[model samples]
Target: MNAIIVTGGDIDLSLLESYISKNKYTIVISVDAAVKKLEETGKLPNVMVGDFDTLADEKRLEYYAGLGIEIVRHNPVKDFSDTELAIDWAYKRNITEIVIFGALGRRFDHTFANILMLRKYKKLGVDITVVDRCNRIYVKSNPFILEKRLVWGKYISFFAVKEKVFIESLTGVAYPVENKYLDNIENPSLFISNEIVDDYMSVIFDGEILVVESRD
Candidate 1:
């Protein structure tokens, strides 16, 4: 089943609307306060997962239930964050290719944590991505291709999540670099902001690579 995940980050309604309009999916999982954003967009998520710490009042919780939204509650002190729980729930349901929204443009720690969660899910063999108005982020451990689209972000950064990533080729970008090693924990900027120039671009990595396609 196709699914979309919304996390508790500052959301861009325009981007969210456009994304949902293009896809026909059975579920949209809202993590934490992201459920409110989904409601503001006039779209109710099929399932909502969070601790509800941010829900100021019981009435707000009732409002969600009144909409027939399935709410999954967790202890605020749990080990996994709300976003991780939502992701796990999706995985268990055999949902493939989850597009995560509202995971960027928020607290730096949350943003970083969510990105790491994306990497973790990469091991589970699910195609996951985090999207916002200006960027689309994902992690890859193997070769992947991106078709020519105008760069959404002013810059594109790639960091080695594993040990090393060997970039095979790049095109249609401003600072195109090919066959380069994106070493982990050291010299992380080697693959930052390499633009695209042609109809397509490709990368072959020996280890995991976190691709952050961002705009200014």
Candidate 2:
């Protein structure tokens, strides 16, 4: 089954509703302020995890608890992030895939950390993707196909997370490459702003690469 972990970050309400309606997410876990966001949508999460620092309203807490939503409250001084705790809860249930919402926000550190979490969990054989208003990010180290139909946005960009990444073959995109090594971080647009020309794009690469699909 697939799980969705909602973080307390910037979220587009319409987009969140779209995902909630269309996607058959078996486990819905909200972290901290995201619980309120989910509540605003008139839907309840299966489980809520957080320290309740930001959401300190007593009545609201009782309201969700009254609805039988399992609330996993933690200490404010805990080491792990609220979102990380939510991921752990969902992953422990033998979930096959995890999609994170509200990961991108005003805070760059939180957003970047959420992106890295994708790579960390993907190594554990869990298919994880971080989705927001304009981007869908995940780390890929194997050959994969990025079809236009399933692509998150019109443009796809690749950011190397490792020291060096060697792309073996790339096709079906506007700027196709073969046997190219992306090792430098100097140029930010080295493998960015690419679009699928035809029906799909194929990428075969070595080392960790953060594949970013954006509306631009």
Instruction: Give me the candidate number with maximum lDDT.
Output: 2
What are the lDDT scores of the predictions, listed in order? Answer: 0.80, 0.86
How much is the lDDT of residue 61 in candidate 1?
Answer: 76
Model 1: worst 10 consecutive residues (lDDT sum): 147-156
Query: TM-score per candidate, in order?
Result: 0.89, 0.95
Model 1: what TM-score? 0.89
- Which pairs in model 2 have colliding backbones? none
lDDT of 2 by residue, 5-28 (tens): 888889887888789899898989
lDDT of 1 by residue, 53-172 (tens): 886567887888888988889999999878889999999999868999977775998888888888788888787888887788888777777765744665667887877766766555
* Cα TM-score of candidate 2: 0.95
Model 2 Cα displacement at 27 (Å)?
A: 1.0
